[model samples]
Target chain A: MYGPSIDRLITALRVMPGIGAKSAQRIALQLLERNRDGAAELAASLIDAVDKVGNCSSCRTLCEGERCTICSDSRRSAQQLCIVETPADLFAIEQAGGYSGHYFVLMGHLSPIDGIGPEEIGLPILEAKLASGEVDELILATNLTVEGETTAHYISSRARAAGVAVSRIAHGVPLGGELEYIDSNTLSLAMQSRKVI
Target chain B: MYGPSIDRLITALRVMPGIGAKSAQRIALQLLERNRDGAAELAASLIDAVDKVGNCSSCRTLCEGERCTICSDSRRSAQQLCIVETPADLFAIEQAGGYSGHYFVLMGHLSPIDGIGPEEIGLPILEAKLASGEVDELILATNLTVEGETTAHYISSRARAAGVAVSRIAHGVPLGGELEYIDSNTLSLAMQSRKVI
Candidate 1:
């Protein structure tokens, strides 16, 4: 009832996914309880992150420097490229390890109803990257949703026309998954990926 | 991330309740995607809130100022004090427009296993406030949970010994609650508070 500034904080926080009025208030209170230095560090982080993050000119991954590390690294094999819908997916794959290949982040998946076109979400840039002849295999690491499949097929057809091999990442039942807990999409995919036992 | 700072931001965000590693990463990237000014504003609010909120000197409610509005308001009847376990509960009551009395916040309910004692959570201050003879009626608005009921009963006994009138908020089945979904305690309360049938 006192500070109107608190309302602004709550409103800003509520704009984020999953945070409701109660959570927004709690987060605001937590923020107000911390010391100035701690608060400043939080503010400084927001400024630093937003101001620093930029597109990696070579790849589409978020970068602070001229190019992303994976994009510029000499050790990474350019012939094998991983293409994901977002920089987040690229980061997820990187965290999982064992891949020393180059990456081309699409930054978004195809969605017609949302009016996000291929060029709008950086698919054409990926096409050019494939056309450079530096990549031999283009791995489609997009989500296993219907849109992702359609986008993968589109990319594959176009990339194949340019003489580059393309492959979609497996989206079958997860490792150690119980059949009862499996979703229809995953179950269908697992069935499609089945091998003779 | 191109910078270790991004990882640090994600780690810091993960400390907040309900935020997982993947969600934290998504939030971090979302902040990066936002304009620097917007992110800066959000960060500033987080910083500012943490810097301002302090416990009210009188009622011990968390506030930005010395005394909470409930304690400072002239129109509110301070002679009839309502005590609750949390600031959130007080806020909820206020939002519902049900009460127009002063409030004493207990921060949390009593829990012996958690090492929380009455003295440790400002019960002495509350006793002193009650003994001051300023409050004529002390309303116990603690939740119906085990610890809340125990704390409320303990506080009520002491208030009665001090010759101050003590009353608890009525309990019953919530409005719009389905009878099939209602629990035994709620059904019992509903029966006890039954009016014209």
Candidate 2:
């Protein structure tokens, strides 16, 4: 370590996901050695983000203002609401295109063992939105993992009780994925959900 | 992107060595979604480093004050000067736990094509330190690439003129590297530099 400030920067960098000791050191040194001005700008940006960005008042996705971009955009379909586990998943869905519906980010999936219940993942906000009668359909776009499935099921039941149609995103072979490499469960699901050409 | 602050943070994160668009987005979203306090602390640390850390007056390595810890330490051998390309390389050598000598970081190698000449890499400072007669042995620990070799040769000639003995670190099979997986040039060097075991 060069000094206390450099060491502190390295230590602070480890709070980021996937950054270990070696990576933290490399980043710290790179920031210090290459572009001090860029480093200062990055620091300012980080602080600004930490201060300004927060949960969207409407859909719970990250936003600088009261509503997220998707929630505020008049072009996006409010009747078909897509529920995702995280903002990263929402970004992935947006990048894929073709989905013009607004999204409600759960921030995390339910984990009963860890005491993360329906309320913990912002299920109440979703239920209240569903009950408002504005959204006609709820598209559960949570991940394929066990926790994601449980969360999807819980939300589906709530939507159904509120007279809103519920649909889970398909689970099968990924696009361009070879059949041989596909897992048995996914192959089975793909077979069960075979559609007309 | 959620907002201007979020986008700015992502752009700033892209300045990091290997972070790309997706990685920057992931990092920004993670920072916004959770651990805002940690992100704020990282920002503070980065600004502190940018404001305080500078080149050591004697060795040109990163430091908070005039001289770095290594240059100020009286216990380390002043007669043996190990020249390296960067502080990261210096850290690697220190972690290896064998050499206990002073170091002079060039910060970069000499590349006339890129307009980075001897003076650009602080050769004048190095020459002045060598001419002082404090150092008897000059250890060239630059990398094994073409530029590194060229820089080492140039430094060796200068050190020789100043009556300081010059030596390049041995190039061969790495300590934990398997011969089969290593490059052909390294294999050739390993064979050429084979010593009595």
Candidate 3:
């Protein structure tokens, strides 16, 4: 119903994660009618980022340089390496402002049905990092999902065999979570892992 | 927390309507991580559309040439001109498959508070078209807002002065809307504008 360029733009907008036909149409019309400058800036930024950004060589996180800022930072402990499923997870931990350690991004967990295995997730690079003797403590910050647990277990064993201590991040009720509303599985985990406070 | 290019891309993604900081980050990361080719295509499309698309000279709707397809089509009746608020509204009317007349896009309604006058909405062009003696009827398909009513009244007065019959699109309960759920203003309008069976 729209001109060729506008139609093409609406179709192209559907490539984003959650955008569907109606949303794509709204977005395309909004950009064309209201904010041409913003649209141009978005286009330039997309081109710039896509052309420049790549995985950090050391940690496999998205970055423009050879190493991510976290990987290159000298103050963060090299003795401890936190394993996460994605760059977004790495960002969440950084935003929480708790850990002051290096990180290794797995990008995804082991999902054999989808053909994602250890090697697919760059586990050999992680093994090499473990064998490097620089990391003494391997922190499992991957999610508590089944695939996450499986990947963590696989990596923990490899790290232990390489003489590195391994620890999994706690899984239970969140800090402000009410026990009554918490799921049974989480409540069970919390009860079983009760600490002597 | 991210590299320069990635950070720029995230910030740029916020220009999109309804995209917040978190959504922007997710979109940027998803594009960079999962579909670089899609990202590149979106960028190319945005640039192409922005560079080529312009307002149709006759209707002021978005198009790549001198006139929009509706304006250029000889089959559409030039005697019945529809005045709409935006190209999106024009597209909506066309999609409904009822109107087969030329359109004049106001782009916006008359808003003195926002300093938008008739001239700002290209009323001079509309006046010239009304004076051309070709259009016998003027259809006001603007929104049901107060501003839209004011603009429609203003244009209707001008059409009357130029000896053109004027009509406003009906205002009342939607086709499938129940009377119980309908707003009082719309219900009152529906009551006043009732057609005898």
Candidate 4:
């Protein structure tokens, strides 16, 4: 039970994911008591990001300007496009490295129950890109969940119709995965998708 | 990863308590994609709180003005003063309710190894308040650790010299506490400090 400004700050802080009442209160107290200047700077940065950042027009990835960094980089292969569900997934791929290709972020997967269908995930833009004959191979790097599989299958059909080859990211044991710790489904997939050594 | 603005936003968010790199990135993405308006409002609120909020001149509690609401309220009992180590503890006491006395926040406790001494906890301010003859009883509500005990002992001696009666908050089993689950030290204290009905 602090003053009005403190109450307002706690309320505002709760908007961030994973922050609850106690956490919001603790963070608010710390900001007010210890790091006022740093808090002010963080606030300014948040506002600046909100005002300046938007979805990249070319690939739907987040960017400060019209085109995202990956989309603007000419070194990335236009013929190899990676499809993903969200911006976080796109960033995760980038962090892993070695994938020097363009990305077409769906922004979300095809979830019909949530009223998110093909158009909702920006399928028209992807189809247009495919029809332009720029992308020869589409890499479906969506998550391995049921929804992701369904979305990937739908996009694959669309890519086939547009005369583009499509490939899904492999599903099996992770690089450091142990068979004992791996889930039964993953172990089965690893067994079923065995490759010639 | 994302864009320059997004990167900056993530870095700024990590300054908040408990947020790590992955959580910061996730929150940044969510803000840009889902709640841009809310993010903007939070930013504005953070700036407003940082620019306006300061310590109460009388009691060292956080406030938006010269005095905190509790210190400014005229109805509270000036004869009974509660001494606390931090504003968080004061707030905790208020949340528990029933206490309606003036407060003198230490802002910290005596930790010599950490370079904190009696002066660091504003002993002079507390001594001045006691000598003013406004306070008849001084309640020590510091934590239960070794530092809290040392601080309380130091303050008790000063308060005795100033002709003010001193009392400490009780250390016993918490309400709704199971006797079997209580720590041995707490059980011993409860046994040693048994009260008459």
Stretches > 4 Å off in candidate 4: B195-197
Per-residue lDDT of B1-197 in model 2, one digit per residue for the tens? Answer: 55698989999998888788888888888878888989999999999889899999988899998899998998999899999999999989998989999999999999999999998999999999998999999999999999999999999999999999999999888899988899999999889888998
Pairs in steric clash, model 2: none
- Model 2's C-alpha root-mean-square deviation from the true structure amounts to 1.8
DockQ-better candidate, 1 vs 4: 4
For each candidate, the DockQ is: 0.41, 0.84, 0.83, 0.80
How would you encode candidate 1's per-residue C-alpha lDDT over A94-195 as one tens digit per residue?
889998898887777788899877886687777888778888998988787788888888888988998998887766778899999998877987898897
Q: Give the number of the best model, judged by lDDT.
A: 3
Candidate 4 C-alpha lDDT tens digits along A1-197: 58788889999988888999999999999888777877987898898898898889999988888898889898889999999999889888898999999999998888989999999999999999999999999999999999999999999999999999999999899999889999999999999999999
Q: What is the lDDT of residue B157 in candidate 2?
A: 96
For candidate 4, what is the DockQ-based docking class?
high
Model 4 per-residue lDDT tens digits across residues B35-61? 988898889889889878888888988
Better of 1 and 3 by lDDT: 3
10 residues in a row with least lDDT, candidate 2 chain A: A1-10
Pairs of residues at least 3 apart in sequence or in different chains that clash in candidate 1: A31-B49, A31-B50, A32-B49, A32-B50, A33-B50
Would you list the rank order by DockQ, best first?
2, 3, 4, 1
**TM-score (chain B only), all candidates:** 0.90, 0.95, 0.94, 0.92
Rank the models by TM-score, top first: 3, 2, 4, 1
Candidate 3 stretches greater than 4 Å from native: none
